[model samples]
Target: MDAWATFWGWLFVLVLIVFAILSVAITIGGFFDVK
Candidate 1:
């Protein structure tokens, strides 16, 4: 049970990190977009 919980915790952290990175990339891309 403990191992299962830890696995989920790590997964959640990984997802959060990926989301943060993607958001930053999008924001920077928008800044540089020619419009």
Candidate 2:
């Protein structure tokens, strides 16, 4: 049960990082498109 909790915690953090990266990328892309 402890191992499962740790695994899920890591997965959640990784997902947040990926989501932040994608959001930044889309914002940058939109900025360039307006140029």
Candidate 3:
């Protein structure tokens, strides 16, 4: 297997997970801020 490809795949997955968490967090924060 190619090391670069494997590395990039993991990086992409990690970034996606992080982005999802951040988006959910922001949505909750916004709801509280408006209350």
Candidate 4:
């Protein structure tokens, strides 16, 4: 049970990081007019 909880916690953090990166990338792309 402890291990499962830890796994979920890490997964959630990883997803958050990925989402942040994607949003930043999109913002920069729009600013630069990259196609």
TM-scores, all models, native as reference: 0.79, 0.80, 0.81, 0.75
Residue 3 of model 4: what lDDT? 100
Candidate 3 structure lDDT: 0.97
A best-first ranking of the candidates according to their TM-score comes to 3, 2, 1, 4
**Whole-model Cα lDDT per candidate?**
0.95, 0.98, 0.97, 0.96
For candidate 2, write residues 1-35 as lDDT tens digits: 99999999999999999999999998999899998
Quick one: best lDDT, which candidate?
Answer: 2
- Backbone clashes per model, in order? 0, 0, 0, 0
What tens digits encode model 3's per-residue C-alpha lDDT throughout 1-35? 69999999999999999999999999999899999
Q: Which wins on lDDT, candidate 1 or candidate 4?
A: 4
Q: What RMSD does model 3 have?
A: 1.6
TM-score of 2: 0.80
- lDDT by residue (1-35, candidate 1, tens digit) is 99999999999999999999999998999888944
The residue ranges of model 4 lying beyond 4 angstroms of the native Cα positions read: none
Candidate 1's error at 14, in angstroms? Answer: 0.4
Residue-level error in angstroms, candidate 2, position 26: 0.5
Better of 3 and 4 by TM-score: 3
**Candidate 4 lDDT, tens digit per residue, 1-35?**
99999999999999999999999998999888965
